[model samples]
Target: MNWKKSLRAAGLVTALTFSLVGCNTEGSYSPQEIIDHALQETKEPLTYYGEYTMDMGEAGGKAQVKEWSKDGKRRIETISENGEHNIAVNNGSQIIMYDVVKNTVHKIDISKDGLDDFPSQRDQLEILFNTVKDTHDVKIAGEEKIAGRDTYKIVAKAKKNDTLIGDIEVWVDKKTWVTLKTITNSAGNKMTTEYTKLDDSAKIDDAQFTIDIPKDAKVEEISVPESESVKLDTVKEQLGEFLMVPEENGLTLDGISLDKGIEDRSEYTFNYSKNGQQNISVTVFKANSNANKVEPVFGEKEMDIRGQKGSVMDENKFRSISWQENGYQYSIFIGNSELTIEDLVTYAKQMTIVK
Candidate 1:
């Protein structure tokens, strides 16, 4: 495992822990008192709607989603050329994913309720009232300006047993206790989360949390894949595009060559132009490896070029990372490359994913 990525993820997770504590701690109030207040707030139901853009590390660019929610769960709907999909999730447990493309449904088991489940933005505000237990050192680093509003900066240190996450920094609204920015460095990748549109209040409905499973929807169990190494010739055959071998650290880089089909998919694929900066690679995995005679490709890991951490999709097995910026998104799968760290990051920065 990449300690940097693990540490960075720990940092982000620590920030989340503090965010939950902040919600439990009212202005100049005790953490326990704040949580009591938050529990009371949950009695009233609410919802919200907004636009969300997720920045997927080296995968490149941003993933845009129009959000809608009701009850206590939040769902994000994304439409790809294949079909529409919805990801319904709450922090630790209660994760529901729907793939209209394949017409599939998946659920997860969680020990506790996570903020990711809340349908209302107000729920985020209310969580500040709950528990204030920290296994490590935590401090309020004063305040900063976020979207014209004053926010409190909270920093946390690493714990002895905490190996995956190192440090975390969070920017929370001083007035509303809402998280304006969250930065986490885990597994070698640095992840940042920012929330906006607080000043504007809108109407949210209950239907957002409801899942009307299509009559034809297929039920499937989703889990991380376990695959070792990559085969060059097989990758070339799986991916419909021609691949060119790029040079880096004396290791061979297998990637998709620019072609007509790739050019055609560029529009719906999001941003493909700016990706020239990073060496781009592609891999095609068997969609139904568990049932049919299919081969799965486990992407390789390289060192970070921009000081960002490497990621573990499934405990260093079948994993992928994405990066988004300037209205574009790019994703690189490890099963697509066989280059060393220096060479991989050099080209990973050039790819993009758009839609």
Candidate 2:
């Protein structure tokens, strides 16, 4: 239970408390109703400002965090009791992070929503609730007051197994549909957070996100996704002459996107649909950079893929196989689609390079 690890996940859960306050009705709220409101907030985005304290009991860590988001720009300031402070601002086009005490800045340029991956905070909350809604016992426990607002306490407990996200208890705002507080116990690791101040309707000054770099501050550069979705017909030209893609496909081609490379390098993502869902994707990029190559550990079995050797490994919920050929790297990510290593190897063998 390293609090540092848990602290990384807290920022995401804290997002569940950032929506607008709903009207406080006279009656109580059902677990389903509360969950629906949270899911709905995903579709309707809002501007918000909040400050909260996180106490990781026993694990021994605490921090004061403040958050603000308006339009597509966002900022987060975190301070520890020991006087350590960090401020990061994402203003659509780039991310600027500065260490106040150290006088150092790290900057990364990104397109609007360029680096944001799938399953947004709202989506993650929706998925968490929907996954346990039918499988677990969900009910509103009682009413409580938090952050000066009346809230309904909803608890969801697993029936037989303590696995699926363990048990969750959340205090939702009565007027503002946001979650004011939450306590989650997953496999014996319990985490709690409470918002001390929140204003979803706050008129946050845009200048708050703007940072003026000092003349003598040290600066470092970082890379991020600066690409957009490209049409299939235009992918070849965008890939330049050095890149190639898989020639064979059994599933429907959902779409293709290209990441503008930092150097003379670029990557192409070919997404394929299965059962009306995009379940398979192949990422082709240059193998020259260490960032693009995937090395297999020793004693690990290797597969003869397209006359070249590669290794297939379990990458979280995805089964990925990354190999290099013709000075380029190709990684196929198929959701644990019940595809055995042999099946994966066979698919790779059947692939023909299309220049």
TM-score of each: 0.41, 0.59
Q: Compared with the true structure, what per-residue lDDT tens digits does model 1 show for residues 123-204?
A: 4333221111343355667768876777767665545332233355666555545455666554445566555444325575
In order, the Cα lDDT scores of the candidates are 0.42, 0.65
Error of 2 at 156 (Å): 2.9
Q: Candidate 2 on 150-228: residue-level lDDT in tens?
A: 8889898866553424577888887667777777654335667788987777998999888888999999987754557
- Please estimate how well model 1 matches the true structure, expressed as its whole-model Cα lDDT: 0.42
TM-score of 2: 0.59
What's the C-alpha lDDT at position 5 in model 1? 35
